[model samples]
Target: MAEKRTGARKSSSDGDDGASSRKAPSKKAPSRKTPAKRAAPKAEAPRRATATQVAARAAQQLLELTGKEAEGVTGLGRADDGWTVEVEVVEVRRIPNTTDVLALYEVTTDDHGDLMGYRRLRRYTRGTPGGE
Candidate 1:
């Protein structure tokens, strides 16, 4: 007669079914946290114009009205409201080259280099000296 093996483990320590090897999972405590508050952004100040930009704006404004070209920029300044620039322009052409007439104009512009207004300060000939 042939005898067949049953294959069953005789002791708990000799077998590993996984359920007897692991411990129960522990419970974790709940966390209590408050979200932080954010600060509001501030408003930015207006930007000021540069000296070069101010002079260029003045010349452009003068040319837009007179059609005459600007000769040079004489002065630049800043006021409470905006910037100021002094520009020289050729007003009238004369027969003799020394008799050519030139004019000094005061131009005002905003902080952003926008031309606001302009006015003629004085007129003189090209050959005339600076004191007048």
Candidate 2:
């Protein structure tokens, strides 16, 4: 009769006893690739002021410097450095509204509507024809 073995059998490969011979999976972390850098956005140029804005700015500035009330804007155009605006203002008040003294001022302003300079072009009564 053959005798039965009571203990576990041994593995011949690594000379290990009949515990698991396979190694546990490694716990190492995965390596990551860095992202590429992006280019910076370009800046925009400043916008020029509109005719209406330039005219209004010129009138207000003339009033502040001359201490006279602006009556109206007669002419507006672009200049080499900025804008040229013609503004009418009351220089002297009179009993009759039509006889009041008025002046025409040429005002210059920058691209952003900031007044650079101003000069009186002509002066006449409000009743004068064509302001000549």
Q: TM-score winner among the candidates?
A: 2
lDDT of 2 by residue, 1-132 (tens): 122222222234434532256675878877554444324445567788889988988999899999999999999989888999999999999988889999999998998789998999999998778724
Worst 10 residues of 1 by lDDT: 1-10
- Residue 56, candidate 1: how far off, in angstroms? 0.8
Task: Return the top candidate by lDDT.
Answer: 2
Model 2 stretches astray by more than 4 angstroms: 1-44, 130-132
Name the TM-score of candidate 2: 0.65
Query: Residue 60: error of model 1 in Å?
Result: 1.0
Q: Write the per-residue lDDT of candidate 1 for residues 61-113, one digit (tens) a residue.
A: 78998897898999889888888899999999888867889999999888877
Cα miss at 62, model 1 (Å)? 1.2
Q: When superposed on Cα atoms, how far off is each prediction in RMSD?
A: 8.9, 10.0
